[model samples]
Structures are given as C-alpha cells and as structure tokens.
Target: VITSENQLSFLNVTRSLEDLPVEQGNDAEGLLNECKEAMDHLYKADVYQSFDEPSLFIYRIDIRHNGSIHSQTGIVGLVPVEDTESVQILKHEEVRPERSDLMSRHLVAVGASSSPISLTYKNDEQLDKAITNCTSNEPVLMTEDSEMKQTIWKVVGETAKELSELVSNKILYITDGHHRMAAAEEALKKSNKNYGPLESTLAVLFPDDEMLVLPFHRRVGDPEGRSSQDLLKAISAVCEIEKSDETTPERIGEVGLYLDGQSHKIILPKSNGNNLVDQLDVARLQEHILAPIFGVVNPGTHKLIDYVPGPLGINVVKERCDKDSWLGFVMHPLKIKDLMDVAEAGELMPPKSSYLMPKPRSGVFVRDLNREKNIQ
Candidate 1:
C-alpha cells in the first residue's frame, strides 16, 4: 500500500507493473504535485482502502535476466535508532547528512516508503532451512520478473519464530539504502517533538551468501578537451602500460585504455600498493594512472577522464570514448571477500563502486520498521 503518486493505482495490495510508470528524476521538482495526485487518487479509491493501523510483512524479489535469476525473502520492519549501531545491524556505505535531511523530509511528506533498503547477512543453516520450510506451502502473492516466476509468503507464527531465531545472533549489512536509513535517523532526530527512538523506520534483510554484489561501471564524460595521447602520457608516468591492439581488457587489475582507436592494458607493477586501499585495482589505477598522469587529485572532478567497470565490458567503454575524449578506464571486479573485509573494517568504498544485483521491489510487503519480530 506504499507508492509514489505515479504508482498510487497499484497501492491497494496488488496491481500490474504496466499500470504506471516509475517515478523518475524529473519528478523530483514536482513533489507537491505528486503528493497532491497521490492523495487525490487515494481519496477517490477510499472505498477499497484500509489503514486501520501500521503493520509489517515479508517481501521477496525474484528477477531473472538471461540465465541469471535470484529469489530473496526477508521481513520488513522499522529499525529503532539504537538498533543501528548495536551490532544487530551494519552499514556498508557512508551517507551524507544533507541527503539524509532531504530524504527525511520526503518520507514525512509521503508518509510511506516506496523503496526498501536492502540489508544482507551471512546465512545461518537454521535460517536457510526455515525459509525453505515457509515456502513449502503456496505463496500469498505470485509474480514474474521477466519470465521468472516469483512467490512471497506471509509469515506470522512458527515461520516468524524460526527466522527470528536464525538471525537473532547474526549481524546484518546494508547493501543499499544508505539514504533511507540515514533519513530515518535524521527524521527521528528532527521529529523528537513528535517521535521517539522507536518511531519506526523501514528495511528488508537477507542472507549475504544468497545476495549478489555486482560492479558499478563508471561512465566519465566530457573530459574538458583532453586528447588521448596527452592523457596516456600522464598515465604512463604512474603505471606500466602494456600495449595491445584489442579494444577490450581481459584480466584483473588491468585497465583497457582506448584513445585514438587503439587499446592498451595499463597494468600496475606488483610492488605498487602495500595496504588495503592501495592494493585495490581501482586505487592502483587511480594513483598510478588517473591521478599522476592526468593531474587529477580527485576522480570526481577529473575533467580529463572517466571510468567504467568490468561488467559493462569494453563495448560500453568504447562507446563513451569520444574524439575529444582520449582515455577510458575500466576496473576489475571487486571480490566478495574483499567487500566483506571492507565492511568488517567499517570502511566505505568510493561512491557507486559496486552495482549490486537483484535489487528488491518495494511495496511487496512494507516493513513498518516498528515490529517486534520477523516471521521467516
């Protein structure tokens, strides 16, 4: 029963994906109008609507693209302000205070959560067994992600008991939704006059092993008129560049540089980095290649180049390389073990470093974030 104005029609428990368009970036400026539209629609549809009290449920997303499809289920609930740092839950990314403020205002205005931040934890054998047992019966809702059939079950008794026991002693990590969680914290702080610590925030948790973390390819555009040769010469000063005729790079810690229609593998010397940050291929490229070669201390403001990830491959890299733009940088995939290590250390990766997959759909089962327990 939670959605943006564009999706109000589907808020009544069920609807088709084709029924409305997802709210896009352009809709941000029209917040008031969007809110008005949502209220108007709900007002007109009050005959079939109910909001007697706030509650929680489980949401599962099963999206399959090509031969890849994944199914995940977890309880939705409002996390208390204190639960965030109690080791019961964890965060993988850093959130900005300004962004949190913005999101808090939006959530209050909307009074609903349309997107569920994804949290993941190491799978306990008991939890896995419990989920399997719950799904043994028919699901309350069944849908399709492309051609993959997805199902969701509503748990309230033993299922919830089993799942709760499985994760009661576990630590959870946030895969996405830094902003949402931060917004909750900020809103609760600002809402002190009307809300308390347990004033309800939202989240969905899953097992880490079953979740997939993908690379987020970078697309650096408009390098402020820098030629490939100029950029290459700058890069050559930092790392070893292996000349190649092929446009795509094929190995880890290797970057495919496409400038002037030729490709080169900008490989780092084995002795380059000595610590965690330095050892990363992305950091290696940046330190030895992007920064030293192009005089860019900050990649975010770098005008001479842009970056892409391994998942996008070389084609996307090539497509973005312009005549005026000389260099295209591609990063090796971040291993799961490394990500886990980073999270364990309570550190953050550069923005959008990972492109996590099988992002769950919102509104399947909104966790009121005020619940006492999660049904498996």
Candidate 2:
C-alpha cells in the first residue's frame, strides 16, 4: 500500500503523478499534461538511461520475512500485446474499466513504463538452471532496504536469446498488472500504427514455484446497525459457525471471522462439481455472506466493504474494528496451481482475492516507448 507519505516523498523526487500539485479545478486532461511535462523534464535531465541494443535483464528480489529470506528471480523484457488475444497470456482477475482507462491515458501521456507487469509460468528445469547461472555472476545493479534487496543483471548475446526462446512456447499467467495489460490494449486501439512500442508492454516473467501468493482479507461495515448476534445468526443460516481461537483460516473451505471482538470459525459447504470460480473462498464469502446478509453484490464497488492486505497481519483488521463496528474475515491464501487452473480455463476470480508479494518496484528499469520498436 502506498500511503500518503510515500506518495508525497515519491512526488518530491520524481514530480510525476499522484499527489503532485496541480491548478485548482484542473481537469483530467490538465493533469495528464502536467504528467507529460514532468516526464519530459525527467527525460531531459537524464534520469533514465537508454540501452543502444535489444537486451533482456534478470531481476531478483530477496525479501526477509518471518525470520527467513525468500528469493524470486525472473527475466524482465517486453511481452507482445497480441499474446492476450492469442491466449498465450491469461488473466484471472477482472479490472474496473475506469481504472483501466486511466492507466491507458497515463501510458499515452508518459510514453514510458517504469514498472513491469508481472507474469508467471509453469516451472521449467532448463529455465531455472539458466537463471541460476546468470545470477551466479555479480549483478550490474543492486538496491537494498531493511526488509528487501533487489538485484538486476543484464543479459545479452546468445544467452539472452536462449532465455527468450525457453519462455517463448510457455503459456504465461498474469500475477499482477491486469489493469496495465488492459490499458496497453486500449492504447494499442487508439494508436492506428501496427508496429511500435505500443505493440508490447514491459513485463517480468517468473516461475510459479518461486512467486509468493497471499490472501486479501475482507472487512465490512454494518450500515443497518445490526447487532453482532444478528449478523452471526444470518451467517449461520448458510455456514456452520463455531467459536475458535484462530484469527486466520488454516485451510480452504474454512474462514476466520472476527466479530464483536471474538474470533469464530466458519465452515463452508462443499462446492458443486462445476464452475471453478464458485469454488474459491472469496467467491464463497460473497455468495454466502456478503451478498445475502449485507446486500453487497459487487464487492469491488461496494462502499461499505474494504480489503486489507494479508501482509498487514490480523492486528490491522482488529485495529480497524476497534475504531468502528465493523466485522472482518480472514481468508486462506489461494494456491498457485488453482490460480493457474482458473486462468487457463479463462475464468475470472473475485476482486481482491489474491495478494502477490515481492512485487517489482518502479524506477528500477524504464522503457522508452518512443525509442522501442517491435521487430517481427
């Protein structure tokens, strides 16, 4: 989550969108012009370096959490936008059209993409070996903070060609940046030119086994002023509820409910042997609890419901509840295989279902859309 402080500090440095000072009553077009001006200044000042030749990069991020270090490595490059239509790249989440439109405008205004859309694929021994070999040498760029360290290595010559070929035939699943992908498509539609930087989007492809998936907990407000007992009674009509000490569910079909300052276990009924989307815990929560009792049919746009990232921990939910008469549900993390399966089936998951960690940070590598050309 990028807090206000983070946005302010970032604006202070980049002077790019988000919390940057604009004229009073300025419209979207005006803000976009400001963004273009900021980007122009950045390019003029040489804030970004351009490579003379086509190249791929190996990006690795090591995160220290829970007394252990988890490392994920991937190849960063440009993925053809056509892959989405060809089904080579699959998306499991539905994006809001407004958000996608805004992103598309941003792409057009900036003419560059700083953050790479994250993609995941089935694990391959050869690909893993090649990435390991590349990382064996000293990295060309390294950045570190207290909890995470990021390293980048440039790949060129035959090795880059080999790496590209290895992933060419593999089906890619989007782990993040669904909006960006949608935005890229929208931008392509606006640009009548067939081949150029608009033909592709910056991406980082990681293997499924190396990527970490976390849960997105839900919290809902009681606008109707229903008591805790009344809410539990309504929930119990659909699911089996029992008092429990656990704040996080241990397995699928089980949900941890924090209501009235107490934790309870909710056991969901078995799903019918059809529709993989219905089998998801988040879907079940919507179908069983959020929709019926709270009348929250669309969690994405619902004003009373909000999502809390699992990495924030259960205490964050508790703190929110303490401030208001809100109830929280802790969800189990979705398995990587299940996500890939749903994407392969061309089905969408409920909003705020999964939180992928160790995301690639922006400003590490920037692609100049004006200079890049898609060579077919």
lDDT for each residue of candidate 1 in 225-302, tens digit (9 for 90 to 100):
566666666667666786788644567677666666677787765536465645666666666655554566776555
Model 2, 1-376: lDDT tens per residue? Answer: 3433443222322333445455535365666776666567667777566777778999999997667999999999999997899999999999989878877888887777877999999988999999989888788888899878999998889989999999999999999999999999999988875647888999999999998999999999877889889999988998999999888898999999999899999998766537898899988888878887898988999999999998899999989987887999999999999899999999999899999989998767878677664332
What TM-score goes with each of the models?
Answer: 0.77, 0.93
Give the least accurate 10-residue stretch of model 2, judged by summed lDDT.
Answer: 7-16
Model 2, C-alpha of 208: deviation from truth (Å) = 0.3
**After superposition, which runs of candidate 2 have C-alpha atoms over 4 Å from their true positions?**
1-26, 373-376
